[model samples]
Target: MKNKLEIKIILSLCFVTIITAVTAVPLQSAHAFSWPCIDRSDGKAPIAVSDDNVYVAWWGNTTGNYEVMFKASNDGGKTFGDKISLSNSTNGTSVEADVAAFGNNVYITYADNKTGDADAYIRTSNDNGKTFGPEFKLTNNSDSSLTSSSLPQGMKSYDNVKTSPYELKVAAEGDNVYVIATGGDKNDTTYQPDVFIRVSNDSGKTFGKDINLSESKGIVSERTEIGVLGDKVFVTWWDKGSDGTDTPLLRISDDRGQTFGDIIDLSANATDSNTTNTTSS
Candidate 1:
């Protein structure tokens, strides 16, 4: 009789413990919602933050054709203001935009086929993203509008259909702006389009001549990016040499792009598939 009573008391305690656990759990808070900053084919958004202001530059299809769009949030990205078209053109599509912010000025650079051929373009905003100045065309590829390379050793080269296709990447510090763009060459593998650069020392107000970064006789170089640190500037790209191998290479300039050091092969040992050289591995 005593054991039976003890079992009943233990079951009663277990029931109370279960009830307390269920009641102690707090209810979850309600989910919050935010309005769409941009609608209609808005993607590839690159954002830059300066102080409390956050700026976004993206390629959108709001215009009949694709164009570069800009917006800013003064309240630390909680809300964004109305959209602004940095390209603001009705011509050929402007794609692949990159943005940078310094002080009160915001700079956005993109590639568009405004004229007969695609070219690199830049626009600046002095008052954050509220307003933009005039557009500046950077590259003059009147001869060859494209950069092309023979297929790597094992791959076959094919003609790619492109209309004024130019890829652009940009980096800026203070009033100095650096842009790297590659035009494709679908014809002769021996003579392909080159990776060229344009620099603007006085912000985006003006630009210098297109400085060719690759060898004049080497196979085509493409997929380039630029970075600036202190007095040095760095540029890197992928290239195909006559040896039939594709290589990733790097070039550095200590005097702010006036000249570049030797091209260092980044993928020199890529043929060794077993070699673990990358940090991610």
Candidate 2:
């Protein structure tokens, strides 16, 4: 009986060794996976990624006129769909375009010069960017200086430019969509560039009252980005001081951007003005 038990135990050990050897070769041969990049015929702006996809939006010259184009990838960054134009006007210029996707809808915010002023526009796509809704103007600046007329000469001067939206940012939490951009009053020289936050509960169909996030009076705060964690929304931007130095700043809102907390300095050293980039995780 002892000899028969020893024979059975040796047979079981041999079977285990065979199984391990068979699996080890395939495991050692495994390679890391890689993703594909989107092909932008004319690359322009940096890519932005949400929970599921990466959106690439840019302004490129099409037959001597600049227009906005977009491409999206659903599989992380594996592959992107074909390029699509967001503007219908021939001579209009679209610049500083930003895109963000939430749930089943994608929101694109950009500065359009079709109305003779650099008015803010938002376009929404519900079917995975297969089609977009009508272009809606977010601002009503009729001033000529804010719009682009022709090629080089019609471009608005930066110093005298007013009534235009710049550095657009969008973030969504639950059913609420929040957008932030810089708007300046053309008449008030003492009026610095202010951060305006607009909220929309029904996707991008309509937006609510503008909320000012900065209180520096005449100081300019630009290059803003928004992120949401739980019920709180955080905004980060570079606050430009009178000495021509830009300092990184951050503001947090615990109540869905309805109210923001005190400005928090994000720089490691308070006196260090050389750093230009800031982000919140």
TM-score, predicted candidate 2 vs. hidden true structure: 0.68
- For residues 1-281, write the lDDT of model 1, one tens digit per residue: 22232332221111100000011222111000111111223347877787888999888776488888888998899999998888876866677688888777888877665564445567788897788888765544343323334344433222122223234666777777777666432233443545666666776666655455665344656667788886677888877767877777777878666677676777666574332222110
Q: Which residue pairs in candidate 2 have backbone atoms (N, alpha carbon, C) closer than 3 angstroms, thus clashing?
A: none
Q: What TM-score quantifies how close candidate 1 is to the native fold?
A: 0.67
Tell me the tens digit of each residue's lDDT in model 2 across 1-281: 22232332221111100000111121000000111111223334856666677777887776676678889888887998999999754755566677777767888877665655445677888866767988876664332222233213532443223233556666766666777776553322344665657667677666655556654556766677888876788878877889998877777878776667777778767575343232221
Model 2 CA RMSD to the hidden true structure, in angstroms = 24.0
Instruction: Provide C-alpha RMSD values for all models, in order.
Output: 23.1, 24.0
Q: What is the lDDT of residue 178 in candidate 1?
A: 75
Global lDDT scores for all candidate models: 0.57, 0.58
- Name the regions of candidate 1 deviating beyond 4 angstroms: 1-43, 141-165, 184-189, 216-218, 242-244, 269-281
Report the lDDT of model 2 for residue 168: 69
* lDDT of prediction 2: 0.58
